[model samples]
Target chain A: MAFLELDQLSAFYGKAQALHNVSLSVASGEIIAIVGANGAGKSTLLDSIMGLTRVTGQIRLEEKSLIGLSAAGIVRSGVGYAPERFNLFPYMTVRDNLLVGAYTARNNVSDNIAVVHKLFPRLQERANQETSTQSGGERQMVSLGRALMTSPRLLLVDEPTIGLAPKVCNEIAVALKRMRDELGATIVITEQNANFAMTLAERLYVLESGVVKAEGTVDELRNDERLTAAYFGH
Target chain B: MLQIIVQGLLLSGLYALIAMGFTLIFSVGRVLNLAYGAYLLIGGYIYFTVSQTLGVPKVLGLLLAAMVGCLVGLLKYRLLVKPLKGNHVAVEISTLILAVVVQAGVVFIYGDSSKILLPIVPGVTQVAGASVTYNLLAATIGSWAILFALYWFVRKTHVGRAMQAVSMDTKGAAISGVDPDRINMFTWGLSGMLGATAGVFFASYTQLSPSMWVAPLIIAVAVVIVGGIGSIIGTLIVAHIIGFMEVLAVAVIAPELRGVFTMLLIIGVLVIRPQGLFGREEL
Candidate 1:
């Protein structure tokens, strides 16, 4: 069995369906990316995994199912989400934000904090600064570092590079790679920037209108003519 | 002059204490707890019953009152708040009705007659040519101690930071593994404890009556409105402003005009800058 598996997952917002019959799987400690256009249900997929939205699916994390668990319970079971909107507690200090993130972890929270700080040295410098006062790039580091504080076996991130400069985007890319390499946690990321997604992820799934339109290794997807037309609108 | 200053300081401290619980629930749950005053009423009565009737030690009575307030707060959250799912209008109406029913319950148990609470600390002391009751002085001291502790708790502790997180962004807090539900419940309980403890002091300052909840509730609403919704230090500052205004009004102007200026201040602030003197996010 795969380390993390989603079998026939569907999601709804009130009467409207957001995601339909989505299936994906990830091996232990591998990096996966979901690329899609606007309103293609990338956020809904991550929310479903985090149990923020109502979902009808089998989300098997190793041997256990994450179907009925609350968001906090999902975190306890070792799944973390970094949303597209960089939802840091704006009033709280940087260190406090990370400290709040590790509330579910019983012990060695300071150690986890130290690890995230090492990954994001900018966060360490602005440890006492309010998150809202920070720049977009620093806030992004704070949001992602906060998720890392939970020490999840699997991490899901959505659009961390939106509205950021390319240089800052590259910095985030390097940090994420270092996270996978150093932390040894499986990661699933969603992005609207197909170029950025292709560069970061080992295997890529092209999502279109809440369904997996095409999925393959980076080389296979890069060579596809349909992907260029569908994704880049060429 | 000294009388106004001394009295204003004491009364402002009590106002801050009473407003603490109300501000907390409003900040965290974003609901107006109309039954908040009932926590004070219950607190005062509980202390009366324990210390006076049962003849328990005063310290134990205060502790018991705080405990009862906490219990009532938790029950309110579980039964009233969580069930309604924080529909603001519904929670407000339900809590208002709950307050009246609780007041009636207080009347039924303790009788409609207002009771004089024996001062927690008896004897009067002369300060700055003004005769100050030890009870009011003790209340002020206790209020300061509690407020300082609460400030430290919110700024320093783990659960407190989680509360700050939830207040700022419930969804964000949850994604970070902080359960908003649990934090809301705890906040409600803490609010109750603070309200009830303040009630014990306030009851002694005035007298124990079921109707006593109204004035303090008005004060709390005023603090929340003018001081901004979520800032504790804002609450303290506005509490003093109202307290001094009332004291000065009574001393300098007609006694009946004590509440008039407070009303005017509330209207003026609401009209001009409803977000409060302090910014909204600085709690």
Candidate 2:
């Protein structure tokens, strides 16, 4: 049985349909990447799963259906989503931001933070500094660390390397891979960086204009010339 | 001169207590509960009815007043705030109307006459040629205790931290598995309790009247506007600033122009720096 599965997922913002009948499944400890251009419904798919948008579909995590749950509720049921904007508390310290993520794990806050810091040590180094003063790359780490503090079994990450340097992007990818290897977290990443996404994921879902255009192993998708031409078309 | 300092310190403590409730509602919920003043009025009347009218114990009366205030705050959230939801203007206007309506209701029952309340702890002590009532001293002590406790709770406790989280970013806090709604509800209740507690002392200091709420309400607003929104330490500091300004005006300058300086300070501060003196970081 798949650890995280989406069945015919559809979402709408006003009259505009943001996602249309999107479906995918991922087993535990697996990494999947969704690649698309801007406005290609990449972020919308992750938002739909996190219950941030008006979604109609079955999102099951470890056999439990996650439709109609609130964002807070979905998060409590071991689901995490980190967007490019990161949504960190600028007024709070890095430590407090992570604690807010571990709100459900009241007794295990310090332990969860320890695991997160081990995954990304920069967070521990800047634990006491106000998040507003941190650099963009460091804030990205904070966003990622905050998501991990929940001890999530399934994580949806949207455009984690949007404006970061290549080295930082590689670090992000490595950290995400570590999240999968160490925490046994199933990751579904959405990105516009097709090349990097291709290298990172074992499987790929190619999206265009709110629809899944192709789905296959990275090697198969990389070999398809027609899909590649259409995927990055201006 | 000595009188001004003594009066300022004592009055500032009470002012901080009053502003704390108003600040909590503004911070966590982000909507100014315009009827916040009415909480003080209602709390005062409740204490009066329980302790003075019925001749019950003062401590029990205080407790009952706080509980009633808590209930009123919760009801306001469910009935007015929750129903209106995203429309901040509607909530503010509705609460203003509710405050007026409540004042009228109080007039209907208690009459328009102001009644002097006996001190909760009667007697006075002289310090440096300045007279200090034991009642005001108790209020100051109580205010300090409440402020300390609140600071500790927000800094240390899990639920309190959730309140802090909601104040910062509601959506982020929600996604982080903190229930913004529940935390908001709790904040409203706590705000009410604090407002009511402050009300009891305020009434004893001045006198009980339906229109008595306006003064404290203005002070609460001034604390936030002058000090900055969502900063607990800022609230405390600005409460003192306003308290001393008012005291100094009455003593050194003119009693008639006491409020005039405060108005000038508001205009100057707002025109100069709108965010506040301490800025918007939550204490």
Among the numbered candidates, top lDDT falls to: 1
lDDT of 1 at B273: 94
Q: How well is each residue in B1-283 modelled by candidate 1, as lDDT tens digits? A: 8899999999999999999999998888888898999999999999999998999999999999999999999999999999999488998999999999999998888789989999999999998989999999999999999999999998888788888888889889899898899999999999999999999999988899989998889899888889886778999999999999999998888899988888898899989998877757655
* Candidate 2 residue-wise lDDT at B129: 87
Individual DockQ of the candidates?
A: 0.84, 0.75
Q: Number of the top candidate by TM-score?
A: 1
Clashing pairs in 1: none
Query: Which residue pairs overlap in candidate 2's backbone?
Result: none
Stretches off by above 4 angstroms in model 1 are: A229-234
lDDT of 2 by residue, A8-82 (tens): 999999988989999999988889998888898998998888888998878899889988888889998998878
Off by over 4 Å in 2: A225-231, B281-283
Alpha-carbon local distance difference test for all models: 0.90, 0.88
User: What clash count does candidate 1 reach?
Assistant: 0
